[model samples]
Each structure stands twice: as C-alpha cells, then as structure tokens.
Target: MEISTKVQIVTKTTTYHPPLAISSFPSVPLITPFARPANCGGIYARDPGDILVIDEQPESSSCYPPGFATDESSFFSPGLACPSGYWSACMESTGVNTITTVTCCPIYRSDVSLSCVDPATLAGVWKSQFCTFIPARSVPVPVTRSSNGRTSTTTSTLVNPGGINAFGIRMVYQSSDVVTASSSSSSSSPSSSTAANLGPDSAGGSGLSTGGTIAIAVVIPVAVIAAIIGFFLLRKSRRARAAQPAALPAQIEENPHKPSPYYDYKPIFAAHQYHGGELPTNQASAELPASSESPVELPAEAQRHEMR
Candidate 1:
C-alpha cells in the first residue's frame, strides 16, 4: 500500500502599523519602595561583583537607609559620583531579587556599571538606572516598536507615586546616540553660521564706542583747562591796566611882548641919538639906565615946545 501524504507549509504574516502617538499613553505612577529589576528589557543584567552605592543618610533621616554615613563621600570614590542634573539609582541583590539600596547619589553611568564602554564612540545601547533630574511630576522616556519590518518611536512618562515630588528612579535606555548627535548638529548649524557672520560687526561697534568715549573724556578736560587759563590771563591783564597812573596836560606861559605902533622905529632912536650928539647939557640925559622898561617918550606938545 503506497500512500503519498501531501505536505503544506504555513507562514505567519504580520501587518505593519506605526506606533501610537506619545500623547495617547495615559500618565502612570512610578513604583516606589523602588526595586531594581533583574533585567530591564533584556538590556541590563545585575552582575555578582556589582556593588550598590547609596548616599549617606543621617540617623534621623526617614527616606534612606540608616547606619550609612551622612556624607556623600562614603558611597563612591572621587570622580565616580554622578554629574550635575543626574541622580543615582544604586541596586543591591537580596538573594532572590535585586532591590535599590539608595537612589540619591549624583554619579555617572560608568561609576556604577561593572561593564566597560567604548571610549572612542558613544554609539549603541547603554542601559542604566541613573536618571536626569525631573522637576516636574513625571519623567518622559522614549519607547520604540517594530512590526512587519517597520519601526516607530514614541515617549512615555513615569509619574511619582510617593507624592514627594522628585526625580524618577527607573531603568533608562539610550540608543542611536550618534544619530541623535548628528540631528542636533544639523539643526544648530544655521544659528552658528549667523552668529559667526555678525561677530566682526559687533566687535567693531564696541571698539568704536569705546574710542568715542575716550575721545570725549580727553577733549572735554583739555578744553575746560584752556578756558580756565584764558580767563585767568584776561583778568590779570585788566587788573594791570587799572593799576597804571593816568597822564596830565602840559601848562602854558603868557607872552609879555606887544606889537609896536610905529611902522618904522629907526627915526625915533636916530633923533634921540642926534640930540645926544648935539652935546646935551645934562650928562645924565645922554646915558640910559639898563632897566627892562622902555625909554620914556615925550608928547607931541612937549616936542613942539622943545623945538621952539
């Protein structure tokens, strides 16, 4: 009996659909008395040699483990602490499950992780419990889904359950760092170019403003000093002129001489000399005194009588 059995192959097919928008996911509270999972989406696994580092708590503290030192230095070595804007989520093994021992240390991923990362490139998936500080009520994380060879990405927020508003403590996955960095660089290129173009103008403007201010400061003082000196010199010149003595007018003397009435006075002197030549009887009459007064002149009648 040769019986041939027909063989059939069945393959499952899936239809691709984009992930729902990040806004669609309702807000969910974060789990508290927070415990670290054994595996977070198959990305991170707790190693046996891994040590849980936690912030030191005081005896009176209620949020953290007791008996730990109150200072943050007790948790890790220098430079191992988380950087600013980040907080640590230290985990410890409880024989059955891993739990968070402390969650308030400021440390980086390499400080807590036992595994080593490539220093040359920050590409690939890096899983850690450390989170960025979230001042808001919730923390947002990106989530991706792949269906029928199609992939999509969205974000979901983790809410605080303890009502004590603080940063969220959860596993965080960072993937495709290179792609993110490239996108950021491309977006920032235009702004950087514009700033570069405006740099020279801004520098020139500042230099011109400084030079103008210096010139004003120097010129104003020099002008003021010159004016003051000029004022002083002018005042001194006026004072000198006022102190000098004034000149007086010259005095004139009166003339004592008068014009003679006779046009020719030679005859009078000749006749007087002739009378004297006739041998005047009196010697005193012939000689005249040397006085400033003119000689006495006889009247016409007296002259007629003398002629007679």
Candidate 2:
C-alpha cells in the first residue's frame, strides 16, 4: 500500500501612513552636492509670523537679505527656516566648507488656499528680513506588487519632525508570505511474499543485536559482583590468619626422679621377726662344762668298789 499528503499556506501584508503635503523636487546642479530646490515655490522664514501671503506677484528687482536666497537660487548660509505657512524644513552639509544648504516645504493647511508661486514672482518679492525661499519636502509613495508565487506591499512616511537642520523623521512598514514542499519519502511497493521474507530476516538481525547487548550488560555486572565477593573472602582469610597463635619450639621430657606437682612419694623399709635365745639354722651353737673336777673323782671310786 502507498499513501501521500500535501499542504498549502497563505499570507498578507498591509501598510498605512498620513498623506504627505508636497512631492520631491528634481536634482539641481550646484557647487554643493547636497543643495537642492523645493518641489514648489513658497516663502521660507525664521519666524512663523513672517510668512507672507501669496495673493500678488513681487517685482523682478527684489533682492533677498544678506545671508538669504530664493528656493531656486543657490547661496551659502549657516542656517535656514520655514515660515508660518510652511510646516517642514531640512538642511544638509558637504563638510568641505562650513556652508550648509537648507530646503523648506509648505504646510498642508486646511485653513488657507495658497497655490505655489512662480520663481519670477518669488524673486520680485524676495526680502532678507523675512525668511528665504528654499526647496520643498520629499515624501515617499507606497508601491504594491503581486505576481508569480510572491506578493509584497510597502508604505512609508516621515514620523518625527525635529527641526529645520535635523533629519528626525522615521519610516516604518511590515510584510509577510508562504512555503510548502518538504523533503520526505512516501511509501513502499506491493510485494507481500518478499515483504514476509524480509520481515523475518530483519527481526532476526534485531534480535541478535539486542541479545548481544543484554549479554554484555548482564555479564559485566555479574563479573563485578563476583570480584567483590572474592575480595571480601580474601580479606576475611587474611584477618583469620593474623588472629591465630604462633607455632612454639619442640620440648624435652622431664626426669622421673625429679620432684613435680603432678606425682606423690613415700619412704620404703624391710620387715624382720625376733626369737628368745635360739638362733636360726644358719647360726652355730656352743656347750657348757660346770662341775667338772668333783664329778670325775666320784665316778672313779664307785668303779673300783664294784670290781672288788
């Protein structure tokens, strides 16, 4: 069996701004690279109240102040300003010399209906005491495009106005889009018998791999346990050996005649019996001879008598 999938995405972008009152002027040829005229002719002044009305044209003989010049005329000055009716101004410097070029633009006033004046009419009415006539303001237009697989829209506007000499205005906008295709495989073929054989082989291979890992894990722990047991046994045996008494030298047997606490002793004598005036057969006896002389004489007399 086989399966497939697809995805789609979309995005949008929008931008808005307060409309600009004046357009950008064309580039002009001048000694200073940053010097340019305004998009329209209008009076520029240091003080807001000094801005004159555009009801009548001034004469051609009019001359500006010592340090001021018309919007179309090029002159050197340290600073510039927009009059009461003008709402914005900008100044840029080349840094080659200390001279700065100033440009000014008319305000988008709902209260007044003053149209842009011609350069000749402006020259005829030029006054140095009032403000100088400089260049107009530069405003950006929004552009939108949608083609191929992409779409984009951009809008811009000046946000902050600091002063005549500073570029304080900021521009901001937003954009968004889509992407689809991904790098992933789909499915497999429809061969049931082939898949069955392959499945067994794959399962066997996985089983073998798992078996090896399990064997290694079990064997390592068992070996460690055995080693620990053996170490304990060896230590116990050493302690037992240290606790046993040392072997003594050989001893000789003691003499039997010597007095000792283990044996007792007594004195021995022979037994004898006594008889009165007789000796044993192993003794010799002696005879007595008392009236010897008298007896012998008597016996001799008697024998003589008998013989007679």
Candidate 3:
C-alpha cells in the first residue's frame, strides 16, 4: 500500500566571498656549514673534495673518457663523488701552489648571479656575478738602487688581463670504469650450420646433472617416508581424540579469603549487635567506649507486659 501527502517546498539563495591572503618571502640565504677563508676581497677560496654539479643532458660534459669529452680533454679529479658539471676538461698543472678542487655559487640557491653583500663589497678584486676571486701577479720591472746605481728585477705571478693570474682551481669528476662480460651463448658459426653437425660447443646450463639426479633420488624416498609418518601421526591423533571423553567445564572457584581492594571494614562492631549507649570497644588495646555506657531505667507506665 502507498500513501501520498501534499507538501510545500522552499529554497534560499546565498552568496560567498573569497578569503583575503597575505603573502611574504624571507630575504635570508641558505649557506653551507663549512668554514670560509677571508682574503681575496672577501671572496672564498676553493676547498678540496668539493662535489661539482652535473650537466647530464650532454654525456660528453660528464666524467667521460678522454676521447668522449669536448676538444678531447681528459676527465679531471676522477675521485670526485658526482659527475663533473659544465667544466669536465682535465689538466696536468705544474705549479708550487696547490690546485684546489671546487665549484662556486651564491650563498642562496635562489641567487643565480652569485651576487651577495660580502662578494659585492669588493668591486674589481671580486667578481660578484661569477663568484670568483681574482688573484694578482707581480711582473718584474726595472728597480734602481739609491746608494748604488744598480738595477734589479723580480717576478711574481698573479691575476692579469683576461684571468691570467687567477688562482688555479680544478673540478672533481666521477670515476668512469669500463667492464667487459661475455655470455656463453652458442654461436651460429659462419663455417658450419644444420647441414654439418660440426657446431660450436653449446654452453652447459643448469640442466639435470649426475649430482642433481642423485639428490632427487635421495630426496624422494625421504619425502615419501616423512609424508607417510605425518599421515599416520595425524590419523593416530584423530583416533585418540575419538576414543577420549568430552572434557567437563572448568569450575571457577572464587577465593573466599580474598581481601577487599578498597579496605577492611569494622569487622567486630559491624558484625555484632549492641544495645543503645553500649558501644563496642577493644579491651586488648585499652580503648575507651565510643559512646556513654550509663544505663537508663524506663518508667512503670512505659513498661508493658505481654504473654507469649
């Protein structure tokens, strides 16, 4: 059966407003924890064992073999952890000063131009955009002595025009190793084919050999005996269960002497009944009665006599 009733419907319209947002960006830069040495116009010197960024798109730019690099330059710093980036060329530099392995960048990754406060403070000595220190060289000029008319000359190497005396730096590249492996695949000899039985010796794979056959022969009997023993044990257990009587439900005997978790009650006074004004007392402990023990006599009129 179905019942129908008339009803009125109502709808309401509503409007929504977007929320206001406040955006901000921090000006601080992220710097590595490594210590920086100050000298060349606040520009840091290249440190040893620095990981260089890799330019992966061009394989030749990476730590490839000498033949694969651009201009056939040998890969430098083969001990570096990662692939050498844009600069992959290697060199055998002969100089008394050390050739530091390094890469330069602004303190913050966001700053691509490598411009910063310390590096910017030095105008000519430090290249802010490139983030490098311009080392100086001392070329010997004619020096005249005041006491004696004698001329002397001394030479010192430093940075000159077109990055001449800039401190030498080398980038570390990933070590490239070559390995050769030959698979034991039977080759279709150009000399012999199906017409001639003289074919290249086929490589032996994990085929069933004498040892494997012996192992299978030894394992089958042991497996069969184990299965038979397991079946018999299972059947014996079933028979034992069928012969046994159903076990009775265990009786949950509660502890009658279990102490109350809360506390022990007034054992003697609560259990025994006493007349009015005759309070219970502990005679052994010499404790006085809690109430007055004086007995009061009832009037003759209040006394009633009843025969049972």
Scored by TM-score, the top model is 3
Runs of candidate 2 exceeding 4 Å displacement: 1-71, 74-80, 95-98, 108-308
Off by over 4 Å in 1: 1-208, 245-308
* lDDT against true structure, model 2: 0.29
lDDT (C-alpha, whole model) for all candidates = 0.30, 0.29, 0.27
Per residue, candidate 1 scores C-alpha lDDT tens digits across 1-308 of: 89999999996543211211111112221211221222221111113322122221123433332222333213311011122222333334234231122233322223121212222332222122232323236644444444566756555454543111122122211122212322334433321111011111221111222123445799999999999999999999998887664321111123224333366334435544544446754445556658898898777675343553
- Residue-wise lDDT of candidate 3 within 1-308, one digit each (tens)? 99999898975533211111111211111111111122111121122211111121123322222222212112233121111111211222234223322232222111111211232343443332222212244432222122245433233232343121111122322111000000111232211110011101211111222233445899999999999999999999999997665432122125545443345534645656666886655334467758667788878788577998
Per-residue lDDT of 235 in model 3: 99
Among all candidates shown, the one with the greatest lDDT: 1
TM-score of each: 0.15, 0.16, 0.17
In the range 8-58, model 2's lDDT, one tens digit per residue, is: 777443221111111122122111112112322322222233223221122
Ten-residue stretch with the least lDDT total in model 3: 174-183
